[model samples]
Target: MKPSIITTLIIILFGLFTVQVNHRHLSRLRLIEVSLNKTAAGLGISRNSPTSMPKASYSSRSRQRHADPEVDIRQLANNLIEMVKMIPESESPKDRGELMNSLATLSEFSPSQIKSLLSEIHKSDGIDDELRKSVMGIVLILASDQNPRAGLDLVISSHDPNGSLMWEDAIINNALRSFANSDPAGALKWIEDNREVHPEVGQKENLEIALLGIAREQPGTAIQWLKNIDPSDRDDLAAKIAKNALSNEQRMAILEEINSSFVTSLDTTEMGKLKESVMAGLGASLDPDDFEGSTAWLENSDFSPEEISTITSGLALKNPCANTGEWISWMVSHLPDEALPNQVTKSFSTWTNNDYKTAGEWLESATDNAAKVPAISAYVSQIVFVKPQTAEKWALQLPEGPIRNSALKRIASVMESIYPGSEDAFKQRHGL
Candidate 1:
């Protein structure tokens, strides 16, 4: 299975957002620009190559600061009593343990219902520390649902310190998500005030998460806070948040506030993310439902395929910000098939001119043979300038049709100085 592009981004986020970060997950060097073209043809980057940080420890001195929302103690106490009566008993301890494990994954219960269920799971005989831990994890996740602060407190109180710290980190993540959904600003404020509290993850780390949340709902303030983050971390974070904004204008507005230049100064991986953003913008512009709809989109977009193709081709050749092969795949995958050939062919011309080996190798190994024609033709035409025989070698292997005819014609055109009637002869032979 392909490793996720988003997972690479997420790991970077996790370190700036939580304690108990996974070292293996951190150590993996994930490529930010995934080769979405990966197929049985070995289209994408090699799977083995991919591409963290210190985390806060549980501080015994940390204290719970958020006030729990009002709850009916009597109702919780009553549910707990009734829950105790329903606890299952079995002669086979394994059977009983299986039942407890399922209870840990329960998803639909209310806050009180979950509380009662947790209490019952605790008293069940034959359940081990590991199984008990799973139940505790569920409690932490569900705690954020209703009365998040209280739910979190209960989670904290129930969590055994000797057990996995990963669970506590998961709980913090869940609670933060919940807080962000209801009151992003408040959530940000809460993290600022309480993140330094003992047992809580570091304030700076959690601030990234809170800022992300607020950024989605209120970009104006969100960008200000997000920019204040360490300069090195801001670019990708800006791109990630901007991608989720409600509209193109909003996405652009958010990114416009970014301190670093995504186009100019960022590393290759971050630049790859920028390339994806531009590609996505181009994709979104392709969203008309019919032939006329495409015309309508053209009226609305920056320019038509020719213009975008030129821009992308120039960027690919100049900065080399993204993978050229993947760019070809992206064009084929997202743009209309008939519409893409000429546009991408333009890119192949530039790519062949700039770095013949990589471009030629990709064209050779690429298995989307149908999509390869225009590019092959373009490369052959360009190669004819320096090596007409080499161009003929390439053109001869093309399937017996227009692409072959086109490539042959390009070779024929180049041979005109040496053989005056060569073009006519080629046209006649190929029935062109």
Candidate 2:
């Protein structure tokens, strides 16, 4: 009786243990399947088959999952080396050239890989023009990357005594365009140093572009270059070169000199063209007040329709709201009847309503009686339309008189229009 009971208990315990082990095994297998599905989705590969799992060594799998920087760098370097070696020495110039270009594309990797390939090309004496251009392309890419100085050094060292004309052109143009904006002085220096070896390297046009870039960073040096050009030549190209070299103040001085010296004797038509050129040059630099003054001067001066148009165009470049109320008044008074006060009011109303604070500041600074009326009206309209709460603040700032009364009336009118029978409600709400 005791043996039978013990055997039954043993069988029951073994069955329970097997059930628990099977459950644990099934849970672990499900987790693995979920992880594999996630990895497949991330890689944009189908997970419908068991073959979706990449076959690789354990170490390779670990490296792929958590990249080892040193191993990645070594593999990248090896790939670049293999690409370079594929360029056959005895192959057609075109084929060898294409392979070199492929090598240059590898410059997106480490600079060290680029340097190694370039050094090998330098050592090999028989490379053709196409291959040379590809090398320079790589150098340009490297110059645009972190180790620009190293790229520059490689370019300087690669000067061929018997290099083809196409090779020289390609190298110079690529290097100039890439490094010119990055470090203009360094670029100009390199060109200057190589001008003797490559006699036609730095032409007037090339030098001008380089100087313009340098002027953006160092104006004094650019001014010195301008001073070196002959006066007759300078007169011919002064507007073009000075357009790049001079600061805003210097440009104004140049315009004044041109006007005093040449504007008086010229015919109306020619003088008009010249004024247009000068105005365009000062388009971004002239202050809004200065534009108003210039416009006044043009109306008084013997400027033709063309000259007037030029001055007006320059004025238009400035934000209309930046013009003082006095200036706007003058414009309304002086402009043709077609450009009426209502038109100005409409434009200013739109601008003020758009929360253009600059325009608002200009409207506030306006002191002219004719200009102030429309400007204040437009501002009041803005408050009614977009910012009712701000209207009271504006009204309170007006001096006690017609202006204050007019503004208050406009605010009341707007409130009545928006909240009928609620003027008192608005007044109380705003503490008017």
Candidate 3:
């Protein structure tokens, strides 16, 4: 088992040399394999070894060579430019059409990016009709985005007089909607600048919608626009929208317009509806002061008694006691006694029956304002029909005048009716 020391030493050196050689060989092999792999990958090889590097490289290179980088960019840019160029400056319909077609295919890019590209194109001059339409198409698509206002602004700013009327209508409508939910003042400014284009673009509806939106924020401005709208196109929808946009002053102005247009024309039905609307508006505001001018307007109209009654009812609802009193005073002072007897009687009946105590108090407080005397007398006479004793007490307090005499006669008549022998006796005692 114990061989010679030299033999053992030789064997150990050989073993050490063999181990070193093996380590160096393994290191070299790893280096070579790594180099081979890298070269293969650089040559486009699949590591799985199913395909050769050259073949894979050729296919990938071919695809890169064939790819179109600007296809999407051109399409988007063309679309935006086309829309902006709709302004007569762009002359080529064919180019615009092509751009439009290209834009229709651009669904991969972000709308904002597309909008940016379009904006760039819009600023460049000499873009033909074809490019303009393309640009417009892109703008149209973007008009549906959450921030379509940008597109709307571009459309409006373009001032494309020669553009398709249909496209103009769409732009105006989208702008109106955006304005309604956001910037009302901006929308009004747009309407003001483009008023002449409205009929040409069939944008009346758009204007109406926009005005309605602006009304909540700037009723005065909105109502002004509404007045300028053509009557030929007026409808319930327009009326409803206009009704909401008006301020007190603007509403009176609109009533003036309606009076000049329809009332003077003797359009009774239209005048009635207009009066009803104005009164309803006043009722909602509950401002008797606002109705003073309106009352005068109504007085000048050939309104039926029923229509006047309706207006008075509205006034009562607006400011119950206050408006009723003001309106009664106005009617008594301005209207001829004979001309409004029935109306006075009805109003008196309403006041006295609803609040006899208040009516009696107001009667006693009234000064020589003789117009109110007949009305007061009528009310007293009517009251005597129900409460003879109360009416008789009130009659005795009235000052000497037609009112007092009328109250006395009313009391005597009622007393005789209730107690058959009282009328003549009472008349004798009262020296009637």
Candidate 4:
């Protein structure tokens, strides 16, 4: 099977020809890409020359631009131009998204470079509207950060024959929101200072975004910011920061700020709705592990009666255990008719589900106690689901009284539901 020398020489020549052809194709692409810089400038596009990047193209045609270490700005500057020239709508959005994502990942390109690249693509002739939309959509994702100068520059300078806007309100809002998250203090100050400069900026959105960001890192500062916003402008924004109150300390801080405001009217239903909304948000923000800490803080705080009622009830519903015996005692004496409906019963019910031994012991000892009926009634409702027999045992132990009768009434009903016709027998056993 030995080949002749002539045959081997022929194979070598063919291999060399293939390499030369491939190299020529790539060189042609580079030339076309680089020449766009000249054509773009003549058409009034300002080409940004960021720090010179080493001359390179993605070594692999399909490799991710970010993950591929060899990718450089000089290579990407023209690559972006060529990518947009691909026949409009010829590629799926997913494919277009990858290209757009790669462009955004080019952090090596200054904001100016990104803006220039986008402008060239938009102004480039022969691209279909569908393809232009795809490019515009991708550019929006890239422009999601705070680069107002570069973005505004492109918009103002664009000679887009189609009258398209790449720097619309959504884009600016995104930039402002992003800037606020990154630099809340500076961003808010900028908004206040630059009102005349960027009058169209959504000041409300910007302040709300900045306040929410500040709430996480500087809650006390956020409270002051909340106070400073025009009262007419303080709609649902407070609820946003209020929801960040994961700790009792943060929630109480928010309440203190609210109390200092002029809306401390307990006599009006409108005021109640506003206060209730804020307290409800704070309650939902509470961490399950903060149950003990919340109770300890509630003891010393000077919350008004209505505020305390709504706020504590909010906490009790999320985690019934937060309504410890002292809380139930306060509710019974001060809010007898409203105590159970306010969901104090839910606290005892939840505690029993978690630690029945402790809850059962607590209930057994509280029999015949004045403030015990609510707790006992709450317990009977919870136990009837899994352990109707256990509920019957607890009910039988109750001495003759309203609470005992309430317990018997609940237990007998649950037992009959569990075992048909057992209610009378259960009542007889408990001497009902």
Candidate 5:
């Protein structure tokens, strides 16, 4: 694929940003900017031909346009190397993006010339390790977009002498994503076909990246494709699909489509988990400023009590600092009693784990008897393992009722297991 418009924008923006960084680097940045302005400037820098240039193909259109030009691939390679090295050790992505944009200059070179340029950079001595890796990463992305097989080959060839591929994670992610975006089936086929030779290509994380790219670019077929993978892999990738849906508006569309697919393809248990994941994603997506509108939407929707509870718990999990009392009060008003206790327990467990001091203080000062009973019960249930003695004290504070009895029973079970022969004494001491 050609250098993205975003890469172009990064180059422009980087020059603008770097102009403000230091005067010493100003001349160098400006020179790079000027070379960018001249599309032919990259190739025109030197007349000496590179030795041992790899054989490759450029489109006939490009070949016909720049046939027999005076160009040095080494000069182009050095220019890219210099630009990357110019980026400060602590420089941000902007500088790196500028380096990427420079790769676009390769469009002016023949495939052989581009290969020669990369080869020169690869073989060049004394190049900074980061500069070489960054340059290779950009090439990998561009090559993947054009041909995933070629991208994979480039990746394998780019490995260090020690057999470790530099920037493996980032390279795999971008390459697989590029492959999937352009040709999902081809990408999957490549991975499956080459799995024996390159087992890492078929690993879960790499597969997830490829599948997610397809989910975004071609959501229509993602479910069917996912179903064909290993059962364990499918479930994990499916959950990720649901959880990632609410990240943005476009992905939300994918979420809806994928939800429909899940209903059709997945079994009841799997579908239920998928729904919870989606609700959790939705819960995380909630903005405090838009809570009322979001709640209104939820209330009008046809979600079950369990799903609604999951969403609220998700919201609480996302922001533990949210007022626990108000959250409990809202759930009490909305959720049926059957779901209330479990949801309260789940939410308070999460809150207590995050900030027990604040959570315990709120429970102590709580005025709403309706919220406190279940809240205290849940708190004790969660803290029992980590703080058994404290759990006993909290359990005793529960009001006299089934909730209190249940909390004490839970504490007894946990404490007895922790300290053998202490169960009867504890029950007797608490008058249970």
Candidate 6:
């Protein structure tokens, strides 16, 4: 049953050839890894850590000559695509810097080259969703670099109207930002044109990205565009535009337009939101050091008592515990009876944390029991665990009300957990 000598020799040689082929294949893979690492280094990307590549503009590319023939765009793109295919599906490969560097390399390719690559990638069954989105993002950016309309069309066609994908918003926002930066009027026109066709494009946050970019360069045009949109959208968008204004003058200009434009009386809810937005914009614009100048702007406005209170709430939300003494004086003078308690509770809590002695002094000196009750409650809440006796003394000072009751109950709850029989005695002593 022994095989012929010639047959055995042939089998041995075949086995040796198989091992050599595998060695060559592994060597090719290692070479690719080394080449890519070198490419990443040249581009200032780290192969081991993820980094965002800046948007590639035509002017930026034009400055550099395409002198390296060995670094052919097509070849680099092919190698990166193959590397992307090797990444495990369950792993987040984008967390690796290689994919981002791959994108940087592919970004230099021509629109036609990008289109060809996209076609090939579309036909590729091995590419995962992460790689697919990364490639699409690069395509969208490059397409927008030349023509916003073309870029938007590619985005709309690739994405589903009803379903969301990872990086979908970022991809769209980046494209719109590039478009708006280059041509604000053109970007606005595109939105107006496509709002009906793609309702998703009309989302408020989406519009803000473009509007912010537009407002940066063209405030007048941005305002004119804002005036024509839905009443509901105008207030928030106007606020955002004002918030992002380049200078104080630009901020005031947008705010004045908002003040002048909504001449017709809006419903209660609309007016409230408008007031809040206006105050929020103003709050965002306030210079922390220029307290006098900042407060002067709001003081000069023709805001009603109710409107002032609402706007003050917005200001507190933006800048809480801002110069606690002066802040309390301003709030007491302006904030309505209904808005006072909640504002005091929140702001004083923050103030007590920063400087309890100063906070306690102010609370004791306050003439208004309305302010004192909530202020005491906030103060006690902060020190309840660390200084329970001080908390009890402060809590007992409050006049009979919901604020006083809540502070007592909080103290009792803490005591119950810390001292076994203390809850009942504390509750009975405080009249529950």
Each model's TM-score?
0.40, 0.37, 0.33, 0.54, 0.51, 0.67
- Displacement of the residue 315 alpha carbon in candidate 5, Å: 3.5
The candidate that achieves the highest TM-score relative to the unseen native structure = 6
Task: Give the poorly placed runs of model 5, Cα more than 4 Å off.
Answer: 1-153, 156-170, 174-202, 210-229, 246-255, 262-264, 288-290, 356-361, 364-371, 380-394, 399-429
Runs off by more than 4 Å, candidate 4: 1-101, 124-131, 143-178, 189-208, 216-236, 243-253, 263-269, 279-296, 320-337, 352-361, 367-371, 391-432
Our model 2 lands, by Cα RMSD against the true structure, at: 21.0
Sorted by TM-score, highest first, which candidate order results? 6, 4, 5, 1, 2, 3
Candidate 6 per-residue lDDT over residues 1-432, each given as its tens digit? 332222221222222222222242223223223333443455444443332222222223445343254444455556656655544331332332354344434434555555555655555566655555555544454444444556676667666454443345555665676667777667777777777877777777667767777888766557657766777788888777766666556756765665566546566677567757865665665653465765676677666667656545545555444466676667777778888888777778877877787787787787765677778888999978777888989888877878688889999998888898899999999888
- What's the true lDDT of residue 357 in model 4? 66
> Better model by TM-score, 3 or 4?
4
> Looking at candidate 1, what is the lDDT of residue 186?
75
Q: Which ten residues in a row have the lowest lDDT in candidate 3?
A: 51-60
For 1-432, candidate 3 gives per-residue lDDT tens digits of: 332222221222122222222232223223223433443455454345331111110122122232244555555465444443442433443433443333323333344555555556656666655445534543443343324455555555554556652234544565466655677667656666756664443356666666667667655455445455665544343355434633545545545555555556437776566556654443343345654665665667665555555445544443235345556676655555454555555656677777777776777766656446555666677688778877777676667876687689879988998999999998887778
Residues 1-432, candidate 2, lDDT per residue (tens digit)? 122211221222122222222342223223223333343354443433222111111222122232233444434444444434443323233433343333323434355545555556555554445444444444443333434445545555555566642223434454464566778777777667766766555655445556667766554455445444433433323344344533454554555555665555556775555555655544434455565555555566564444444444444444554444445555665545444445456546655755557666776666655455566666776766656657767776666777666677668767788779867765565445
Clashing pairs in 4: 320-347
The TM-score obtained by model 6 is 0.67
The positional error of residue 27 in candidate 5, measured at the CA in angstroms, is: 23
Q: For each candidate, what is the lDDT? A: 0.51, 0.49, 0.51, 0.54, 0.60, 0.60
Candidate 4 total steric clashes: 1
lDDT of 1 by residue, 70-135 (tens): 544335434433332233322333332333323222333456555655565555565455545543
> By TM-score, how accurate is candidate 4?
0.54
Model 5 error, position 141 (Å): 11
TM-score for candidate 1: 0.40
Clash totals in order: 7, 1, 14, 1, 1, 0
Name the 10 consecutive residues with the lowest summed lDDT in model 4.
Answer: 5-14
Candidate 6 Cα outliers beyond 4 Å, as residue runs: 1-103, 123-166, 178-186, 216-224, 227-235, 242-256, 264-269, 319-322, 353-358, 364-370, 400-403
**Candidate 5 C-alpha error for residue 137, in Å:** 10
